[model samples]
Target: MRVLVVMGSKSDFHIAEKVTGILDEFGIDYDVEVASAHRNPKRVEELAKKDYEVFIAIAGLSATLPGVIASYTTKPVIGVPVSAKLRGLDALFSIAQMPPGVPVAAVGIDNGKNAALLAIEILALKDESLKKKLEEYRERMRS
Candidate 1:
């Protein structure tokens, strides 16, 4: 499955790279890009039409990347709110308070690890090996 990791700013690279690492460790193929909901809105609209099973949008501040993706595609979009000023309250509120209809699966502020895990969960639906690996991963975490 091809997963897309999109960030609103290049500044999110440091945090978002961890998600890249997790995907790499799982042997999952992914494409990473920086696309702004404000600046590169057209690019965002285009990627929405491409073939990707899921999207993980990592952004702070206004944090509308996930909602934008959700609006553009039927594929699942997971929002990872990178911590911004105001102790990430701004980020959390921006992501958590979505109006009716548009929904995004929001993860913790700067928690790219969970973002990767969530992506794996979604992909594991059709992959038995991936499902077993995820089960083992969770077991190791608990034990």
Candidate 2:
């Protein structure tokens, strides 16, 4: 399975790096891009239509990236609320409080690791090897 990671700004690269590391650990393929819902709405809409099983959108402040992405595609979109001004609460609510129909799964503030894990879980649905990897990972966690 392939995942698309979109960040609202270049400053969010650190968070994206953590996500990519987790994806790499799971041997999942992914593409990362820097696009903004507010600054580059066209790019966000365009990328959302690409061939990807899941999408992880990282943004702070208004945090419109995830919602915009969800609007354009039916694919699962995970929102990572980056910690910016107001301690990321604004971003968290912006992602979590989506209107009906368009849904973006929102993770905790600055928690890209969980976002990647969630995407892996979704992809593992049809992949036995990935499911085994997740089970092993979970067993390790319990150890």
Candidate 3:
């Protein structure tokens, strides 16, 4: 399966790399795009329509990326809060406090690593082989 990583700004690339690395480790394919929740909403909408197992939204200021993805897609959205002037507190609040109906699993600030893990978890739901791979990955982590 493939995942999509959408960053609100090009500056968030460093953080998105962490998630992409994890996907590589698991042998999962993914595509990355630079789009703003505000500046490039149309691209975001289009990406949501593409074939993707998960969407990792990374943004520093307001954490709007994940919510926007969740609003448009039935696929799972995992949010990576990037470091900001507020030290990502604003982003954390914005992502975590999503309305009850729309859910975006939020990760720690700048930790696309966790965002990737969350994506794997969601993918495992319908993929037995990937689920086993994930279990092995977790076992290896403890080893």
Candidate 4:
């Protein structure tokens, strides 16, 4: 798969749907998996080791899933913070505050659509057809 969408729990599937919808519109290949950083670190590690070019990690509370994925892989990681509690500010901060070296791009809380768009943008860098599609998508948005 070109992209792997990992959620911390099944409860985050609603947010994951937002991400997958955009990916589907863009014709990007992706797989969705539920693995929590706290509850199942090994599963996260295994998922990270997969051959996907990009990862979109959806998590709330501590929001460590993205950072943990980043630690395991060199591929680009996009963090989508869910508003499970605290209006999602706490999740937002947790995602945004990754330490140096292991960098993860953070999107706005509950903004899975942007995360998918960003992932498509990254893939477009090496793909001419995807680049053209993105250009067309942006034009559609502008109109």
Candidate 5:
């Protein structure tokens, strides 16, 4: 299984790295893309069609990338709100307050690591190896 990590801008790549770094720790396969819900909506639409188990969309400001991605696919989308102006709260609300149907699980401001963990947990639901890995990860956290 693979996860797709998309960001609204190239500048958000730094935050996205925190996600990929944790995925690497768990040996999860993933791909990253720089696409914006406003500036590059078409790219986001197309990428959503690609094969992937989960998506993590990172954005700041009027963060609409996560919502846009959620609109195109039924797969789980986790949002990481980058700490831009408004300290990312605007983004957090934009993502968390998505309308009734289009759901996007949002993490804390600039908390890409949690976004990654959430995605991994979703994938582990049907992946035995990943499930075992996550169990070990929890054990480590408890130690």
Candidate 6:
């Protein structure tokens, strides 16, 4: 798969659906998994080790999933902060304020679509067809 979409809990699946919808439209290969960094650190670590070009981690209320995953692998990680608490600011800060060395790209709160688009952009670096598709998508957006 080109992308791996991981949610911290089953409740976040709704947001994940937004991500998958965009990926589907772009015909990108992806797999979804529900694993929490707090509850299942080992599983999160394992998932990070998998072979994927990009990762989209959706979490809220101390969203540590993205940073944790970024620590495990050098691949790009896009963090989607769900609006679970504190208007999702807590999650947003947690994701955006990653310590220097380990970085996770943070999207807007509950913005899975942008996260998916960012992943596509990352993948497009090495994929000419995807680059063309992304250009077409942007043109459509401009209309």
Query: Please, what's the RMSD in Å of model 6?
Result: 0.5
lDDT of each: 0.90, 0.97, 0.89, 0.97, 0.93, 0.98
Candidate 3 wrongly placed segments (more than 4 Å): none
Candidate 1 global CA lDDT score: 0.90
Mark the regions of model 4 whose C-alpha exceeds 4 Å error after superposition. Answer: none
How far is 29's C-alpha from truth in model 6 (Å)?
0.4
What are the per-residue Cα lDDT tens digits for candidate 1 across 1-143?
48999999999998789899989988899999999999999999998778999899999988988889899898988899988887777887888888888888988889999999999999999999999999988898998
Per-residue alpha-carbon lDDT of model 2 for 1-143, expressed as tens digits?
39999999999999999899999999999999999999999999999999999999999999999999999999999999999989999999999999999999999999999999999999999999999999999999999
In model 3, which residue pairs have backbone atoms overlapping below 3 Å? Answer: none
Candidates in order, TM-scores: namely 0.96, 0.98, 0.94, 0.99, 0.97, 0.99
Q: Please report how far candidate 5 places residue 120 from its true position, in Å.
A: 0.6
What digit string (tens of lDDT, one per residue) describes model 3 on residues 40-119?
88998898888898899998888788998899988889988888869999998899999989999988888899999989
- Please state the error at residue 65 of candidate 1 in Å: 1.0
* Clashing residue pairs, backbone N/CA/C < 3 A, model 5: none
Residues 1-143 of candidate 4: C-alpha lDDT, one tens digit per residue? 99999999999999999999999999999999999999999999999999999999999999999999999999999999999899999999999999999999999999999999999999999999999999999999999
Deviation of model 1 at 111, angstroms: 0.3
RMSD of 2: 0.7
> Candidate 6 has which clashing residue pairs, if any?
none
Give a tens-digit lDDT track for model 6, residues 1-143.
Answer: 99999999999999999999999999999999999999999999999999999999999999999999999999999999999989999999999999999999999999999999999999999999999999999999999
Where does the lowest 10-residue lDDT sum fall in candidate 3? 76-85
Residue 54 displacement in candidate 3 (angstroms): 1.0
Candidate 4 versus truth, CA RMSD in Å, comes to 0.5
